[model samples]
Structure formats: structure tokens, C-alpha cells
Target: MSQELIQAVMVLTKQKGFAPEVIFESLEAALLQAYRKEPHSNPDAYVELNRETGAYKVMAKKQVVETVEFPETEISLLDARKIDKRYEIGDIVEADVTPANFGRSAAHTAKQMLIQRLKEAERSVVYEEYYSREGDIITGVITRVEGKNVYINLGKTEAILPPTEQIATETYHEGDRIKCYIVEVKKTTKGPQIMISRTHPGLLKRLFELEVPEIFEGVVELKSVAREPGMRSKIAVYSRDENIDPVGAC
Candidate 1:
């Protein structure tokens, strides 16, 4: 079971591009929760997992005191000294409380919890990745059209191009590859919702940046854009160098 857990974590880390530490932390937390629900579990116990070996131990933290008022949270100095002779009254002793038989049901519960945590982490990673691209242009293939929404497959995730964001005269079909400007990115319970647009002025601005070397290199600046969806659009431009003609560059 321990070897299997380690192998699963490694597979997920490689396939999902997630850091190993993130997976380990999530798994440890999940296992800790599962351990807490066991029959003889201690409230003051925590899980210590070996990253390399995947072995885990549930340890209870007890403070050494002259008088053990709380048996669960405190240990008498004499008892503590028995475990470790150097232990003092004020010292903290971590006692292994791992179950002799951590049943199959408990392991199953831990697996489910780990899966849930990994999904949430994946959603957060996807949200942050697309959120940073909000105002940028991306190319994707139209996957499907549902009512007034067109779904585009952007390799890693899907994006929504709503009717309001589409060009008035344009028609969308599945398998058609197109470019869109990312307007907004939202994190929802379902997942990351990427709102893209075909008619946004930023789309033309981005096109200019992609096609024109002068604009992309900062020698030519695109001042503003006025567009009428599928109709013609106009852009104002200026050049930093007097020798460079921004209009000719465009």
C-alpha cells in the first residue's frame, strides 16, 4: 500500500505537471484526516510521511509536565524520561500512535480524499495559468456549439466564446481553428471559465503585434482601435523613430 501510494504520487506529479511537494502535502493531509477518524485515534496526533519510502506514522505530541492533568496532551516527566532519559519537565515528547492495522477501508478513504485535494489543486493551477493570459490572444479549435455558446479547445482547457463576443457576420463550426482575445478569466466550482472574444478591439491590436515586427518591438505604438465586428476596423499609430513610418510598417 505504501509503495502504491508513492508510485501514484509520482505518476500524478509527472502527468499533471504538479510539484512533488504539493502532492505529498495533499496526500499527507488526506491521510491525517483519515487517521483522525480511526477507532483509537488521538486528537493531538499528526501524520509523518516518509517522502522516499512512502511509510507513514501517526505521532501524538505530548508536553512533559510534573503532573499529567491531560493524559492525551501531557506526559509526566517520569514517563517521558523512561522513553528518553534526557527529557525534562518542559520538553515535548512525540509518541508513535500509528495503528497496528490501518484497515483497507481507512486506506480507501485516504485515497478518495487525496483525489479530491489533487482536483482542487489542478483547478487552482489552471485558473492561475489562464488568469495571467487575460488580455492576450490564443488560438484554439472550435469543439462544439451549444445554444449561444461556442466551446473552443485550447489544448490544456476549453474556452467559451459567447454570442455577444462573436462577430455579427461570422459563423462558427466544429473543427474550425481560430484566434480569440481573452477578455476575462473566472474561477468557478466547475473549473476555470475562460471568456474569449472575436469582436474585441484588443483582438486586432494583438494581431498587429503578432504580424508587425515594428509594433511588437516597441518602435511603433498602436494608439487605439475602432472596430465594427466583421466590418472594417481602423487603428491609430505612431512611431518612436522618426525614420520609421508607422503606416508603412503596418
Candidate 2:
């Protein structure tokens, strides 16, 4: 790889929030797979990346033996000594099996592989982030409406608000700012699929924490919540201190 390409890769990985070591691992795995797919590739092939020079090599790691029984994994001592005189019978040698001008097709394939891996990494990150926020409230904008189902954009990922989970009196439309409780988060092949609900009792409890300063500051302890969705709701609260009134604060 050239210095310019290496710099571009570094910038893109940073932008994508990928660590350098993970990027290197992904590239190395991609290179090894590419090497194996070539017509004259060895089965015991490996990939080597020069971090300082931005140069990479795809070669076979073979053990030097007196008689070559498995040519792919073991090389003749005479043949190994031709490349390096110090190669002994039990020594291991790296024989360069890199193709001529691999930068053309192989480079394109490597870029594609990196992008695919990066997307998977991003999805995993989103899943972990939202998974921890389960039973918590999230603010999102209604982006799409499909009859009974609605999709809300929550910055990094979109969440599904089914009709069953929606408030009975709420008529959601595009661009509506809505607060929902994250009921569930699933890891799907396309991406992270989140199930959000506006009618859940947890949503009302979370809304109280946000709206009431006493609850947020831990002065008031919220005991329980019961809601009939869009109609009526009941909450039980108590103050930890003598002077604070939790019922009046809400």
C-alpha cells in the first residue's frame, strides 16, 4: 500500500469510530482470504502488514524439511536454503506467493471487505448502546408511517413503534417529536431492530423522572406507575426527606 492510501484508511477508520488494531485485523483477514482464492495460492498462506511502511505481503509459512512430503506446508531444505542460506531442516520460511500487481482487483476487493466489516462493527456498537438503555426513555422523530406501524429516527438507529404499543389517542405523523420507552432491542441481519412503546407504564415513569426535578435529583422516590395508555394514569411517589412533598411536585 502507498502512503497516501494508508493515510486515507486511517482517516476513514477514525471517522467510522474503528480502532487501528481492529482495522488491521480486518484487513489481514481479508488479505488471507484473497490469497487463498487465487489460482496458484497455497493452503497455508498468511498475511503480513508493515505498519511503518504501509506495505503488506501475502505469503505461505512453510517448514523446511529434508524431504518435501506436503509442498504447501513444508518446503525442501535445499529449496529453502536457496532463498536464505541459514534455513535449516526444522526452520520455518515465508515464501512470497503474492501475485503480480495485486493492487488492482485485490485492492478493490479489500476496500469492499473493510467497508462491510466496518458496517457490522457499527451495528454491533449501536445494539450494545441501546441494549443498555432498555426500559429507559428515548426521544425520537417520526420518520415514516406505514398504516399501523411507525418508524422513529433515534439518531444512530431507527426504532419500530407498533400500533399495539402506541398510545390510543396518539396519531403519529412524520416529523413529530415523540418520547418512547425502549421495550426491546434485537440484533438482526440488516441492523439493530428496536421495539419502542409510548403506551408502556415505564414510559410514564421515565417521563416523570424527566419532568420532575425532585425525582431526577433523588429527593423523591417513585414507587410504581399504572396507566391505561392514552386515557388515565396513576403514580405512587414518596419523599425521602421530611420537607419534600413528592405528590405536590409531580
Candidate 3:
């Protein structure tokens, strides 16, 4: 890699919220793909970066042999000795054979591999970030409507608020702002999927938690919640602090 390439990679890593090590790992996999394109290129290659210079190198392993059966796996002792004098049969030798550009086709392969790895990394990040938010309330903007289901944009992810999960009296339109409870979070091939509900009992509890400080502070406790999605719900509450009025708090 050159200075220009390193700078470009750094910019992309920061912009895409990817770690440098991840980008470099993807680069290593990309280089292996580039090697696959060139038969002379070593498959058993180790990619390393210069600590001081910030340059990349491709290393190869060559095994010494008396009579070479597999040309790629074994190298004659005579040829091995030319690279290193202490070469012995079955001994593996490491060689440097880094290529420049690796041709347009190889570069394209590397780009595609990097993109695929980056997408997987992004999905993992989204899943880890949202998984813990189950049962919590999230504010979202309605983005689309497909039949009875509404898709809401919640910053990092789009949540599906199904018809069965919607409140009975409330109506939504595109760009309408709404709050929903995160009923579940699932990992799919596309990305992290957040299933939200407007009529879940958890939604009312969470809304109360947001509206009343006593519940949030643990002075008032919500004992039970039951709901008929899209209709009405029931909640039972108790207060550890006798001085606190649970109903008044709500």
C-alpha cells in the first residue's frame, strides 16, 4: 500500500465507523483474492504492515523437498538453498512477493470482498447496539405503509409496527412522528430488525416510566400489565414508599 492508499483507507474507516484492524483484515482477505487471480502469486501468504513506514507486505511459505511432487507445495533443496542456505527437506521457508495494483480485475475482486465484509460488520454492530433495547420506547418517523403494517425510521434501523401491534384509535401517515415499544430485536440477512408495537402493554408501562419519576426511581412499582392490542389495557401498581401515590404519579 502507498501513502495515498493508506490515507484513503483511513478516511473510509473513519467515515464508515470501521476499525483500522477490521479494514486491514478485509485487506488481507482481498490480497488473498488477488493472489488467487495470479497463479504465480502465493496462496499461503501472510500480510504484514511496517510499524514505522505504514506499508503492506505479502509473505509466502515455500517448503524444501528432494523430489518435488507438488510444484506449489514443494521446492527443490537446490532452489531453496539459493534463497536460504540452512534449508532442509520438509522445512518451510518464508518469502516476500508483494505485487503492485494486482491488475484491474484483481483490484475489483478486492473491492467486492471488502464491501461484503464491511456490510457484515455493519450488521453486527447494529444488532449489538439495539438488542439490549428490547421493551424500551423509541421515537420514530413513519416512513412507509404496506397494507396494515407501518415502517418507522428509528435512526439506525427501520422498525416494523404490524397491524396487530397498532393502537385502535390512532392513525398514522407518512412522516408522522410516533413512539413505540421495542417488542423484539432480531438478526437477519439484511440487518438488525426491530419489531415495535404501539399497543403492547410494555409500551404503556414504558410510557408511564417516562412520564412519572416515581416508577423510574423505583419508589412506585408496576406489578402487572395486560393489553388487548389496539384497544384497552390494564396496569396494577404498588408503591414501596407509602407516602407516594401510584395512581397520582401516573
Question: Whose lDDT is greatest here?
Answer: 1
Per-residue lDDT over 69-121 for candidate 2, one digit per residue giving the tens place of the 0 to 100 score:
87767889899989999999899898976888776667778877877887888
lDDT of 3 by residue, 39-108 (tens): 6666677776643354666777878889987765568899888888998998997766666655445567
Candidate 1 whole-model C-alpha lDDT, 0 to 1: 0.90
User: How well does model 2 score by local distance difference test?
Assistant: 0.85
Q: What is the lDDT of candidate 3?
A: 0.80
Clashing pairs in model 2?
A: none
In candidate 3, what residue range of length 10 has the lowest lDDT sum? 48-57
Give a tens-digit lDDT track for model 1, residues 1-250.
7898889988998999999999999988888899888775778788888999888888898899999877767889999988999999889999877776774656888889989999999999999998999999999999999998999999889988988899989999999999999999998998999999999999999999989999999999999999998889999999999999999999
Q: Using alpha carbons, what is the TM-score of model 2?
A: 0.84
Q: State which candidate, 1 or 3, has the greater TM-score.
A: 1
Note the clash tally of each candidate.
Answer: 0, 0, 0
